[model samples]
Target: GEEAARAAGAGDLNVLIGYDLRFWRELSALVGNPYLSDFFHRLRVQSWMCAVPHLRRAGDLRGRLWSGHCDLVEALAHRDGRAAHAIIAEYNADSLGLIERLAGERSG
Candidate 1:
């Protein structure tokens, strides 16, 4: 699951990943949709969920999970539209590993 998600997200890091800084500008450029301010609230919740204590217990699972996100976002935004969104969708779909890890920490 993690591998698949990484593969998906590896393709479209911009459109799907919200914590990425480039999310808004690229979004505006592509779909003419501006970044909604409320998105940050969701971002914090999602990130906090990922950076929880248990996952980070081994001194990992904390910090930035995907620092490469913005780079991919920028790359995808400048490329084709449908293709870019598809890649982003792949990334969104592939987020299962992070979710699993997060769930594991929550349960344990």
Candidate 2:
């Protein structure tokens, strides 16, 4: 995951997205709940559907998104659930903000 994040930081969106899905899928599976795993899969796909266009428009993605993924991986590695949760929360908020900003640019 950290390697993927670094690739993403180098501007490879496909690598980032692919690894993100895999990361979440594995994490959800670790909970041993098939339902949650399925839900996460669907949710991730839907989010990509909505966000990909905007993301593509941004150019220079190197510093624009998912920079926290490496930190999240570190948190999980250390078994610090609280830190992991916070990192995820921050990532989601940042992603939403980026989408919103890009949408506004499109509309305006």
Best by lDDT: 2
Q: What TM-score, computed on C-alpha atoms, does each candidate reach?
A: 0.41, 0.86
What lDDT would each prediction earn against the true structure?
A: 0.48, 0.82
Candidate 1 vs. true structure, TM-score: 0.41
lDDT of 2 at 18: 84
- Tens-digit per-residue lDDT, 29-105, candidate 1: 45543455456546645764654553345343223244334445556657766765765665566455666766776
Candidate 1 ranges with C-alpha deviation above 4 Å: 1-35, 40-42, 58-64, 67-71, 102-108
lDDT of 2 at 4: 63
lDDT of each residue in 1-108, candidate 2, tens digit only: 775678667878888888878877887898899999999899998988878887888877887776777788789889999999999899889888887788888899
Error of 2 at 84 (Å): 1.6
Query: RMSDs, each prediction?
Result: 8.0, 1.6
